[model samples]
Target: MKGGTKKIELYDTTLRDGTQGEHINLSVQDKLLIAGRLDEFGMDCIEGGWPSSNPKDEEFFKRAMDLELRHARLAAFGSTARYSDRIETDPNLLGLVGCGAPVITIFGKTWQAHSKTGLGISDEENRALIKNSVAFLRNAGREVFFDAEHFFDGWKDNREFALDMLKAAEEGGASRLVLCDTNGGSLPHEITAIIEDVRQHTDIAIGIHCHNDGDLAVANSIAAVMAGAIHVQGTVNGIGERCGNANIISIIANLVLKLPETGASVRDLTQLTSLSNFVFEILNLPPDSKAPYVGRSAFAHKGGIHVSAVMKESSLYEHIDPALVGNRQRVLVSELAGQSNIRYKAQELGISIPEGGEQIRKIVNHVKDLEHRGYQFDGAEASFELILQKELGTFTPYFEVIESKVYVESGIGGRNVDQAVLKVRVGEEIEHIAAEGDGPVNALDKALRKALIRFYPEIKGIKLVDYKVRVLEEKRGTSARVRVLIETGNGRTTWGTVGVSTNIIEASLRALEDSMNYHLFTLKATEPKPAAEENH
Candidate 1:
């Protein structure tokens, strides 16, 4: 197992902490899959959920016992023993010892207010719980991590009492003392001050854990590291309850790329992006495209000036080589695009266009005009490619639509059905087809495919995965021009096409037509065929 510098240890709680986010849910199998991936990504530790909480967590720990992890050691999480007569019979403590994990992390209330009101315990009793819990878990042959919940707020409220909790845990043989920003309200300066002060008085190694309610979790974590922290704990993509935990994604990039002297680095830094998206994919949630280092748009260049600069000297616009983190630079086309945009996009899409020619100006002007009329070519590159083919006089209509009609009707049993009737011509033969579907778009898609499948059998493989419509002018209400974007995929690949019109159905048909046309172009491009006959 390859590990990061011993100066700083990486602990991930995504399986436990990440699942607390609003839409984040994972099965036991899902957690196990992520654990293996994290180990492969070179994580130092993976926190399995508190086994005492539910049966799912217990099952997760049981199943995780055979993970065959290469790098990360699995840890179990729980709070210290509840204030009870006998610590030996504590269920939470017992669950921690027998969770089949080598490491155990137990959070105890350090804030005097929480200890008094939340736990209904005195200061001395709370200290006893924290100390005794660590001792009990250590005696069970498990390495103990003591998380001081609300540590910063506790220090600010009563500096001496907070210091006593650390002493209590250390006296009981805690291996690592983690200071947590439970409410996530501490600023960077406060974190620096508190962690430094705590460092001087504590004997155990200090770790940092932060929440994102104040939106400074990452900032505060870095601040804590500079102060004295030697361990960092967070969830991937910052998924957690409320705002979130500190984003381990951003933290890892900063630590490895910017603070390597701190001995924090990953095994393969290039796999960072795949890891970020993998977690989102497993949880079935959309990734935040603007996220640093790993997001789709992180290195995408849009403005004409920026693209021009990036083309000449990539360092002028890009902060770092996108390939360093498994991302690439993309030049976007929009109404704001210049001739440079057209030239760059042509080469990027593998379409040929002469540079500094009248054809380039015409294409640029046409793009501006179309974008002014509610066409967004930036997101629909397949639609833009069709425009390029048309300008070059190399595009041919695979199937021409002669006429189309669509309508929705209610059934006898309160069922609603939409139907589309399409008259399409492939070569000299005409196909008139009608298909019923759940909605207007689906009906159109089905009817169009049925009309063309006889000639292009490959049309059966295309599936409409996404369809979205945007109103250009909300004030015009039903009279407003609408823009439609459709996404099509064939298991192996996906492409987007776009359309615009005041009539929603007309706009949909335009996007659908573009999608089918682009699919045919791709099919012909990859398959061996006579060159001149394809252009017809």
Candidate 2:
């Protein structure tokens, strides 16, 4: 309803193109999970994968059938028939038909250089490939989409051939003609002009797919939309081959919030951030902290002046209300934190503060002192919460450590194991526990958890997902100060906690303690107070 007569369509290719990214591999189950999320996010089309390409993709298609998708049409992707075979006899094209998907996408070389060198085929034969494949899929009652790969480059080298390819797809009964900026080097102006030229020559609906090699994929996608292209094809978070594909999250944000007349319809915009994180989590990759709309630092303020202004009027610093996309605004506490930052952070943590200026000043000064000692709270909010709660006189220690030790040995059978012994006092009871692990840190984690699990059984739900250590001072050599950052997750949610000390084990222990305490705090907030706590 917002944009003009052109109804914009969003096509997600995360399962197809996104897996092409380096170090990105998704199992069939992972692909199916993402497909469901995309359907719920209201994408008009979801490219499942290339069924002919791999067994994983073929298995994904088999599993995706049982999904109860509501909004999106599933598409199977493949290239045109081989130049040496007829369209009906080509195994790749037959595989696409056998995929049982309602829609099919076929791509063929449009660039002359690729046609001659990449495929070793003539220019006319390439056009036939596009036409014959599209016609065959259409005849089989599948919604066929023809992707003219490298259309922009082909148009630049020989404009006539590129235009002829579009005509061929249309005549071959393709429901849509997609112009792919596969190399992602075209600027916004070039995309707009070429789209306008394509529109002048053909009346069929057009789509665009762009890579991020030039960091202009999003810009070029929007430019094409403005120039009357109806469909935009991209991967979530721009994860694809080379530099990646155009980020569909950024494109949706710009279209629905920034553009006035793009005629784009987005459902449940609040799920944008959650959807972005879901994909990242499935891939076991950390979410980008500075991503355009859904990142952790997108609307976070750390400067004193900025924090004060944002507290008075959020619009003073932020472009949009972060909640619109399920992201929350954060006031980071650091050396630059002012009184407003302290108050806002305290309120978020549900801490009660007395009406006094001296207390907030003391907390701010204490943070500055700790920062000077190489402690960074900006990225570790859980540790900052504990410090704030302590300074506010409402802190309670979950457990008091009495002593801990580690022992290592190599067995006679060529097996090695590290053992840790820990003693801790929970309220009035002392618990001694020992556990074996692959390493010192892991053994310590196991032993500590064993000591506390009986009293606080919720601790069993938490697991350490990431651990990073940094030496702060090289001059001290083995005695150098170390900083440890630990990321913990409870199967559903994750948090980061930090610790620093001269001893590496001590630093890790501090971070590990903070991680458990944070988990306990969250659990207490949701569930009833434990019966064991009443005894204290």
Candidate 3:
């Protein structure tokens, strides 16, 4: 909280604004866990939630009292006092004082339209509400940050009134005046110009909060900081209402790298990728591979020329050393790949490939052949790894399916059931097994595990977490080649395997086989375990 620009503060609103995102619902315990993570990540302030509006937030605050945060201060968010004349009787004010958090952030309407319609109050009443709310919370011994909600729109509507609202907060003892682009419709140039004007009128530290409707929240926030705002407010991964909030992860990386004099945290920005993935994991959401700096494919190279260039010098293809953000450069092998792609991918998998050897050419040609047949190696590297090992004569089948049968039983006026019967051989021993599932793929997966369960006891924990099927050559309709990609996990790690075939069942079986084989070959994991939140 004290190192940059006479001190730039990083206030995290993930628990509050982030939970407002579509499909985002965090329980009290989830909020607690995230709060701890943010504190560990060196956030200056963590907005717990609006205690006056929800029981979950009230409970979170009560439970968070015992959180042993080292540097970050907990903030309880709310709005201004309901009545201007007597601030003591307002429940919103009382909850802010009773929440037990050291900091309280209260938002008030600055736009005259919002004031007239939303609160049905005059300009004078609204200003009184803002000033009284801050003074009351300050009197209660709470550090206050006044959130001038809709401040940008308000400024566009009536500049003098919006600036006056900030002056009221400064007069009433608010530590920071956070200008909110609640509608997320402002341009960066407009933000800089407005904040520059406000700087001449108000001496209190300024902060910026933004929504991503126009996909420029991060840009607008940076623009505010450049215009002399000392505090930055945002959510991790930019999860919030509508288009979500400004991504704090990207903002931190930008501030630390581009404007080193602005980041408040002492934590290294190298952990940005892990932190980004951590939030995605908790939210049960897939990461955006194209996300800046910290996504899975941020530094990935696919073209042969790009891979060759990167092999000679990574900086030739990458913007920054990926280690600065906990991401690594990746070389993808597919039909579009060259020998460099094959060799780079082989080395990444810890396999030695002879430079310009006949083996490398064979492997590259095989990959191209497979891709021409509707297989995609870039999306299923586990399957690609298997292919590479086999090409190098280093892979052996651990188990083989001698014979297999799948049955779909008719259930009139009810749900149908699928059964898979398999005769699998492991070494000299054979196992016959049958299993029932909701569908043919599930049944086959269950039957395969049952057939080889005793032989490879470690595979009991393996589960097919995700299965995706795509139809190739759509002109062929139902008879088209089917490509199946399966993600398998053992509660600790997940790997992707893919197969392509004219028959859907065959494609699924091939993908499933590769998934199990990859697990058995790479991870001899032991025991049946509970489902856990993990990623690879």
Clash pairs (backbone) in predicted model 1: none
TM-score of each: 0.96, 0.87, 0.91
Q: Output the number of the lDDT-best candidate.
A: 1
Off by over 4 Å in 3: 1-4, 399-403, 411-415, 422-435, 450-461, 490-492, 523-536
Which residue pairs collide in model 3, if any? none
- Tell me the lDDT of candidate 1: 0.90
Q: How many backbone clashes does candidate 3 have?
A: 0
How many residue pairs clash in each candidate at the backbone level? Answer: 0, 3, 0
Which lDDT tens digits does candidate 1 get at residues 149-245?
9999999999998999989999888999999999999999999888878877966799999999999999998888888788999999999999999
Per-residue CA lDDT of model 3 for 146-224, tens digit only, reads: 9999999999999989988898898899999999999999999999999999888977888999999999999999999
User: Which candidate number maximizes TM-score?
Assistant: 1
- Candidate-wise lDDT, in order: 0.90, 0.89, 0.89
> By how many angstroms RMSD does model 1 differ from the true structure?
2.9
- How much is the lDDT of residue 310 in candidate 1? 85
Model 2, position 414: C-alpha lDDT score? 75
